[model samples]
Target: ITVSNIHIKSDLAIGEEVMDSLAPFIVLKGQDINTLEGLSLRQLEEGIFFMVSPNLKKFSRLRSLDLQDCNIYLQEGKTRSRTIGRAIMVRTLSCFENLVRLDLSFNYLLGCLGEILDALKLPLEFLSLRNCDLNEDDLECLANSKHALSLQELNLSKICQFSIYDNDRISSNNLFKIVFCFKNVKLLNLAQNHFQDSSIPSFCEKLPQNLKKLQYLDIAGNVLTEDSTLQICKALAKVKTFQWFRLTCSNNLLDEALGHLNQAHENAVQAKQRICGLLSALGRTDIHIEIVKLSYAIFVDLMDVMEL
Candidate 1:
């Protein structure tokens, strides 16, 4: 079961009786009854959370866990309780033997990726650490971790957002190298990141070669230049495993991109058509050849802005 926005202050929130009631569904000896694969505990804070770690371990057969925005961290102090709290957190997470999907998004976990990766014996198939205050070290650790080989879907979206200066962006450093490690990944979201204005030449060259299995790629709000667009289309055409890969062309992007669509409708359409033509020419599979998808919102936005 999933619980969210729960300010679990006291032991009564997830008391023993509640835990005991879940036994027939998760633990009792029957194939249908014991099929619980996921448990979500969003916003389950640390204070009373530690008291129930042992009870959570009963969910050993769980294959998915969502602890998004849970503040699953030890408070800073040199006290024995803090150390014990961190250890308990790790130990509890480590007990889930079959876990394949984990969403720790918006957790603000600082310098703790390595410890968590080390604890997870089984490799995760899907992981989302969006807006987690991630750094270069975390990406490096993930690239080198056992999870790297197994990860099929990864969301590192908006991890570097709201920066005062794009000059200090991670893409200018070893971040691309870390990206190269996800050779088997299918769905990869690197949206809303600061791509150095000179552009990701390395991304266009290496992305298709590195992420061969990639089906869906969301590079939506990176302020992509025309050259970057052409290059990305070329790169995407190289990966030939998936059915129909969309280059979104955004017809629009998120809120950030939607605002700009009104002024540049003609240019955007031409650009979108150009990309479709390029993909059609490159031809991973047979296409009708006139492939440009403009969402209804974009169509209406264009009509509103267009002069009669």
Candidate 2:
């Protein structure tokens, strides 16, 4: 069975027949592809309806599984009492030993990172568990996974579990678990969380230096301050491989520190120009100009104090 561009409803009996047909490729849009067997299933917006039966090993040939935007529900009336989708149960995932990429993002998943970690058996290169209700244990489990060691991009953003008044229990700077768990991650996104200034320095000091391959870092929508910003800059400067740094404190107080930072940058530039002129006089104008350009770019891109 080589069907393309198909739609499946909640009818389970018909879906079972299609799964047993030994199809090589199956595409289900707005339908649950959970019934299809012996094919590479591509599920688009069908994540909400996915319900893994205990006997999921029938699809032994499934290589690529995409379940984006699935809704996962916790036990009824547990936390938010809403339909949330998380990674399928560990028992169901154990059946797919050939999977390469598993995208379980934009779901209503709760704390089930351990189950997800146990289910990953293949050489997965990309995994997205974004917006899931993750905690310290979840971070630890992922960091310890053998499959995760080879991952190039990992997105674990928006994993908060605190109401406005519950800030005291949730430390804004909960970076220890993350830094230790994803020590080898190349791209990390920690946007829209409860990070604070006091918690920033510890994160900066303990960040994995082995993350030299790290290219992108996003810590936006938190409560970072000038002191925290300086610590971050210092930490970033130590990592020679970092290319893009995005720090978002949109609603925080970062205005007063801007003038001081600007003045420091200007002084550094003036000193560099004097040294570059000396080098140019010694017939090394090309090297001097390249260094100057790099420095200027860093100065321009560093954090600018935003008015409250």
Highest lDDT: give the candidate number: 1
lDDT of 2: 0.51
TM-score of candidate 2 on Cα atoms, chains taken together: 0.58
Across 1-308, the per-residue lDDT of candidate 2 in tens digits comes to: 44323322222236557553222222232223454433223222233244343334555445555544434443323343222333335556777877766766655444466567676788566677755655555566676777556776776555664745453222445544555455566777665556767677667776636566666776655555545655665566556556665554323333424446575457446644654455445454433121122222223313221210
lDDT (10s digit) by residue, model 1, range 1-308? 53311212121235555553333234323323145676665554444345556766766777887766566664434689766766787898898888888888767555567777778769989999866765666777899999998999998866765546554334533655677798888888765565553556777788777888887776544555667667877877888864444333443345434665565566556776787778778875432222233343224324532521
Off by over 4 Å in 1: 1-33, 44-52, 74-82, 162-173, 197-199, 242-268, 285-308
**How does residue 194 of candidate 1 score in lDDT?**
55
Superposition error at 269 for model 1 (Å): 3.5
TM-score of structure candidate 1:
0.72
